[model samples]
Target chain A: MLTAQVLYGLTACVIVALGLRGALLHASLLQRVVAINVMGAGVFMLLIAVAYRGPGLPPDPLPHALVLTGIVVAVSATALALALARRLHAEQDND
Target chain B: MNTTNLLVFDGLLLFSIVGLAWASLATTDERRSVILFMAFGLVLAVAWGRLLAPDVALAEAAIGAGLSGALLLAAVRKQSPGSSHTHANPDRNYSESGAKVVLQWLVTLLCAALAGTLAWALLHALSSAPHDTLPRAISDNLVASGVSNPVTAVLLNFRAYDTLLELAVLLTAVLGIFSLGQTTPGYQPAGPVFDGLVRWLVPVLILTAGYLLWVGAHAPGGAFQAGATLAAAGVVLRLTGRSRIGLPDGFVLRIIMAAGVGVFLLVGLTLLLLGRPFLGYPPAWAGALILLIETAAMLSIAATLLLAFVGGQPQSTAVNAAANRQREENSRC
Candidate 1:
């Protein structure tokens, strides 16, 4: 159980790192959007991990709600980012 | 499973999630990355289940994998490679200078440090912090809160404010997409087979989404999940050329997009003016209010999510109409 908890927490950390690296290193706007979302997922994992009480206890609902809110926020953010990407590409075409 | 087996399985699940996420982000092929991202969402849905959040797991599967994946895929389909303005900009040419490499290293270090701190906080906070028992309070009031499911109760009753703001946020994203710039020519795959598949699937999709919404009162189904399911259907419709990018013209479009937030605010304010708290439904009216709100929210969420995939509304529906006319002409020929 402790291993489950620690492994997930560390996975979150690695995911955040990988995503941040992608966001920084990638040139394409779409890639950046995807990276940022992965980073968001990492944060969500961490939030959910904290909600996991040891052994028999049910996980916390508040964090679940918070993560749900985060998911919605993420979709919208992706939408906006993709929209911006589309516009950027169109602008380049015109030029 | 023994504890050892459980740990190994958990480790593997975490591995797949992190691995998929990395593969999605690290890939040079945009389309492959988007596809991998979808798979990542599905795996994470399982992780949510492992965490014992069925509501979230349901939501993650529908919204994260299904709708979000389609949206990203549509965005991917809309663009031609190397078209973005950044391609022309010198800033993207990071290989030209020694200074740039140094700066890159600095940024990488900073981000890694940020991730490290977050992990440390996660590890320490759980062991040290006196986390309050919020579930007890929620369970204590579950009957009067007007929902049997604790998650639903938290979403629609006790923390109704969060849900209200959430709907507003969805609307805001739709508005942002609308205000951004333009919707590219929509992707309507041309084929009789595609059309037949879409026709067969849409009604089933609608039924499933509605069933999910209705069951949300006592189970893992709810407005967000239902809405995303509907949005997934809309995505299919949009892709198959049955539905256009943006819906009917701007006026109806605005109304549909605004419906969720508009009704939610109205109901919440009505309660406040009637000497109750904002978002406080009368005990007898809770189920009715939730159902009504969820219905409105499902529509609004579906429309907004579909529009978000579409990217933006045009000045008129005429653009889609013209495309339809062209498609008809091609079919006739």
Candidate 2:
């Protein structure tokens, strides 16, 4: 169980870094949006890892609930960002 | 599972997750990248399941992987409006200049440092004996929280204020999308085969959404999962060229979008009036109250997600129906 936790936690950290690199380096707005989501997923994964107790024992419900809320928030944020991007594209077409 | 076996599975899952994320970001093409990201979400969902978070896994599958993929794909289609097969990505060769390459290296180093710091801190935290206080507290109060499921109890009872605020955030997002502009012209009507599929798929999705909502009080399902499932039905309907997507426009749509937050606030205030703390339900009434809140929340979540997928406020169905009739008459002429 400890091994699983550490592995996932470390993996989450790496994913977050990769996402940050993409968000900073990518030129396009859409790619940046995708990068941000990847970062959010990493954070969620980390929370879930922290919440894990053992193979049979029920994990911490607090972090589970927190990650659930985060997922919804992340999707909404993605939607809003994509809307802004689309509006920008429409405006650019006019220009 | 034994330690070694579990370790191998964890390693493989983690490897695939990181690979998928990297591949998704590395691709320059928007459609390819979004598709890869969706695949990443699915794999991450599996990881969540492996970590023993069935609720989170279900949500990741529905909202994270499914609906978000649909939204991103729709945005990609809009980005390259003229053709289904888009040309090479405009952002494809970004590392040409010397200055850009130097910046890229610097940024990469910074991210690596961030990852190293996080991992170091995580290892230190894990090395210490685990804290059992909070989890113990949750289990103690689990019965009082009114739901048998600890996660549901936390979301709906113990930490309900957070859930309420989360609903507000969702509402804020949909409102932002609506303010941007009208929705894109919808898809063409589905062909016969797809139409038949929709007939079967939509009903099953709706049934599942209802089942998830009811099962949430005890199991791994809840308002968010149920709401996303319901929204999937709407998305399918929208994709099949149904402009209305079963949504009543104007006042009704606004109400549905606001329902989650509105119901939550109303319940909180009512409980306060009854001399309980905000969102603190009496133990005896807690289960019923949570169910009430979850139902309203389910409706609001479904509306918000469907609208977010649609990308903007839709025009009323009346105008849309009249336009369709006019077009039909013109074709006859």
Candidate 3:
């Protein structure tokens, strides 16, 4: 159980780093948006790993619930960001 | 499965998840990148299941992987190919300068350091004795929480304020999208075959959404999942060139958009007036109250998500006129 938890946790850390690198280096708004979502997914993986107890035992429900809430919020934020990006592109077109 | 098998499975899953995330961001092509990101979300959903979070896995598959992909794809489709504005400004040559390369290295190192620090912190936290206080309290109080599913209990009862706030955030997001501009002109109508498929598919999706909402009290489903499924039906309609996409006009649309937060706040405030703490439901009433709130939330979430996918304020008057013309033509036929 511990082995699995540590493995997922470490992998999540690496994924977060990759996402951060992409977010910072990528110039496009869409790539930045994707990068940010990736970062969020990594964070969520870490939380789920922490919530895990073993193969059979029921895990922590708090983190599971929190992550569920986070998923919906992430989508909403993505929608808003895409809308803003579209608006920006339209404005640039008029100029 | 046994420990070794589980270990191997976890290893493979995490590897693919990381690889997919890396590949998605590595490309500069918008459509390809978004498609890869969607794949990443699906793989991540499987990982969530492997970690024993079925509720979260369901949500991730539905909202994270499914709806997010749809929204991103729509945005990509709308981008006018002639305008290089939305694309990354790849025209600027960064490789020509030594300082720029140095800055890139610094940024990479900084991100690596951040990852290292986080991993170190996680290792320490995991090594320590796990905190069982809250979980124990939750278990002790589970019977009175009015739901068999602990995650749903937490979402609708123990930490309902958080869910309430989340609905507000969703409301705010849709409003922002509305303020941006009008929705794109809808798709060309589906052909006879697709039209036949949608005729049956939409009803099935709506039924599944209802089942999900009802089953949430005992299983790995809830308002969020149900709402997303419902919104997907709307998306299918919009994609098939339905002008109104099943949404009501003007005042009713705004009401549906506001329903989640409005109903939640009203319930919380009413409980406060009854001399209980905010959202503190009496055990006998808790189940009923959660059902009421979840129903309203599901509607709002569905409307808001569909509206978000539409990408802006849907022109009600124009859509109504178009629908009326279609109706006249059908009557004549």
Q: Could you say which candidate leads in DockQ?
A: 3
Estimate the overall C-alpha local distance difference test score of candidate 1: 0.80
Per model, the share of native interface contacts recovered reads 0.70, 0.85, 0.84
lDDT on C-alpha atoms for all candidate structures: 0.80, 0.91, 0.90
Supply candidate 1's per-residue lDDT for B12: 89
Model 1 agreement with the true structure over B121-216: per-residue lDDT tens digits: 777875675466787787788888667777888888888888888888888887878887656564547599888987888888889999999998
For residues B1-333, could you state the per-residue lDDT of candidate 2 as single tens digits?
688887888878888999999999997778889999999999999999998999999999999999999999999888887766543456455688888889899999999999999999888888899899999999999988888999999999989999999999999999999999767778999999998999899999999999999999999999999999999999999899986687776898889889899999999999899998999899999999999999999999999999988888886677567757865775676
Give TM-scores of chain A for all candidates.
0.94, 0.97, 0.97
- Model 3: iRMSD? 1.3
- Native-to-model Cα distance after best TM-score fit, residue B176 in candidate 2, in Å: 0.7
- Write model 3 residue lDDT over B1-333, tens digit each, in one string: 888898889889988998999899888888889999999999999999888899999899999999999999888888844453345566552444788789789989999999999999999999999999988888888899888899999999999999999999999999999888768657988898888888898999999999999899989999999999999999998888878678888899989999999999999999999999999989999888998999999999999999999988777677657857865775676
lDDT of model 3 at position B218:
87
CA-only RMSD, every prediction? 4.4, 3.6, 4.9
Which model is ahead, 1 or 2, in terms of DockQ? Answer: 2
DockQ of the candidate models in sequence: 0.65, 0.78, 0.79
Report, to 2 decimal places, the DockQ of model 3: 0.79
lDDT over C-alpha atoms for residue B277 of model 2: 95
